[model samples]
Target chain A: EPEVTQTPSHQVTQMGQEVILRCVPISNHLYFYWYRQILGQKVEFLVSFYNNEISEKSEIFDDQFSVERPDGSNFTLKIRSTKLEDSAMYFCASTPDEKLFFGSGTQLSVL
Target chain B: GIQVEQSPPDLILQEGANSTLRCNFSDSVNNLQWFHQNPWGQLINLFYIPSGTKQNGRLSATTVATERYSLLYISSSQTTDSGVYFCAVASDSWGKLQFGAGTQVVVTP
Candidate 1:
């Protein structure tokens, strides 16, 4: 099965430093998404991307956050100046149709 | 925005037992899916039943889109089936999927 691959299974950063999470979605998939889950909380939608642009974003995705399909395969989420509350398990997903295929996720920890 | 409600926040079952999990949404949905998040936090896609029924091994799912509900049935449960089951929906305005709090299940031998 084709899978979405996220780099750096775990990351730790200082509260004020910048952090970028990278993902390589399935080759044939048309839609890509980023979601997060705070410890013990529900998974929350962050943003969706298609046609090399952002299709939609949630309130949690504010000015500090940005997503890019920098290359044909690499989709990335950059957080300018991370905050303690930004710590969570971030998931990258892709879909050829309506069914979603999720990655193992990257655990972001801000000190 | 649509509200998703999953029944019985917690469930426990013994091996060889069968169980059913329910997901109810506040509005009509074009897309609905059920995911199993293991203790390690990996979200496994179990089923994408927007409507009708589909069976995969010991698991099966049915979605009555008109009734705004979906049910996941697990037969002959095992320890490997222990995890948190989440139901999510994709609404019109937001193409991004929104997830419910999830139902935690603990299957023991």
Candidate 2:
């Protein structure tokens, strides 16, 4: 079956440094999303993208974060300056409608 | 924002036993899905039952949208079924999912 794929299975960065997490959603899906899960916490939605633009975002998706569909197949999340609290497992998902396919996730650790 | 609550936060089952996991939501939803997060942290899609019932192998799910609750049933459980089961719902006009804390199930032989 076709699946969403993410890069940098694990990443470690210093606070105040910039980081980019990447994903390639299923080819036919039109909606893409970013979600984060702090250790032992429920997964939280960050943002949703459709039609090459952000459709909606949560309060946690503040100025420090941004998402882009830089190419036909690549969707990326960039954190301008990482913070210790930003450490979490970030998941990328895509959907044609109600059923979503999530990537294996990128574990981000900030020191 | 919608509130999601999952019951039996943790469960332990012996092989060949049966189990049922429940999820309750605070509001009406356009999307409701169940996922299993494996030991390696890979989220695997299990069921997308917004309403009614569906089954796959030893797993089955039923969603009563009007009641705002869903149930996932695992029959003759196996060690491989051990993991975290998450229930997510999308309410309001948009499709952003609100997730429950999840139920950690450990099946032993």
Candidate 3:
């Protein structure tokens, strides 16, 4: 079965540095999303992207966060300046309709 | 935002036993899905039953949208079935999913 794929399974960055997490959603899927889960916490939605625009975002997705579908296959999330609290597992998901496919996730660590 | 509650936060079952997990939502939903998060932390799609019933092997799910609840049944449980089961719901307007805390199941031989 076709699945969502993410790059840089794990990343470590300085507190004031930038990081970009990349994902390649299923080829035919139309909607894409970014979600994060802090250790021992529930998964939280960050933003949803469709038609090259952000459909919705949460409060946590503030000024420092941005998402882009620079190409037909690549979707990415960039954080301008990482904070210690930003350490978590970031998941990328795509849906052809109601069923969403999630990637293995990228573990982001900020120090 | 919708509220989702899952029952029996933790479960323990012996091999060959059966179990049923429940998910309750605070509002009407157009999409409801059940997923199993394996030991490696990968979310495995189990069923996308927005309403009615569907079955696959030893697993089955039923959703009564009007009643605002869904149930997942696991029969002939195995050690491989030990993991976290998550129930997610999307409201009638958008596809954004709000997930329940999940139930952790441990099946022993």
Which candidate has the highest TM-score of all? 2
lDDT of 3 by residue, B2-107 (tens): 9999999999999999999999999999999999988887788899988999999999999999999999999999999999999999885356789999999999
lDDT of each: 0.93, 0.95, 0.93
lDDT by residue for model 2 (B1-109), tens: 8899999999999999999999999999988999999999989999988899999999999999999999999999999999999999997434899999999999999
Q: Write the residue-wise lDDT of candidate 3 on A1-111 in tens digits.
A: 889999899999999899999999999999999989888777888999999999999999999999999989999999999999999999999988878789999999999
Q: B23, model 1: CA deviation in Å?
A: 0.4
Each model's backbone clash number = 0, 0, 0
lDDT of candidate 2 over A18-63, digit per residue (tens): 9999999999999999999999999999999999999999999999
User: What's the CA error at residue A46 for candidate 3, in Å?
Assistant: 1.0
Model 2, residue A82: distance off in Å is 0.3
TM-score of model number 1: 0.98
What tens-digit string does per-residue lDDT give for candidate 1 at B45-106?
99988899999999999999999999999999999999999999876523777799999999
Deviation in Å, model 3, residue B74 alpha carbon = 0.7
| Candidate 2 residue spans exceeding 4 A from truth | B92-94
Deviating ranges (above 4 Å) for candidate 3: none
For candidate 3, give the lDDT of residue B76: 98
TM-score of chain B of 3: 0.97
Which candidate's DockQ is highest?
2
Residues A33-88 of candidate 1: C-alpha lDDT, one tens digit per residue:
99999999999999999898898889999999999998899999999999999999
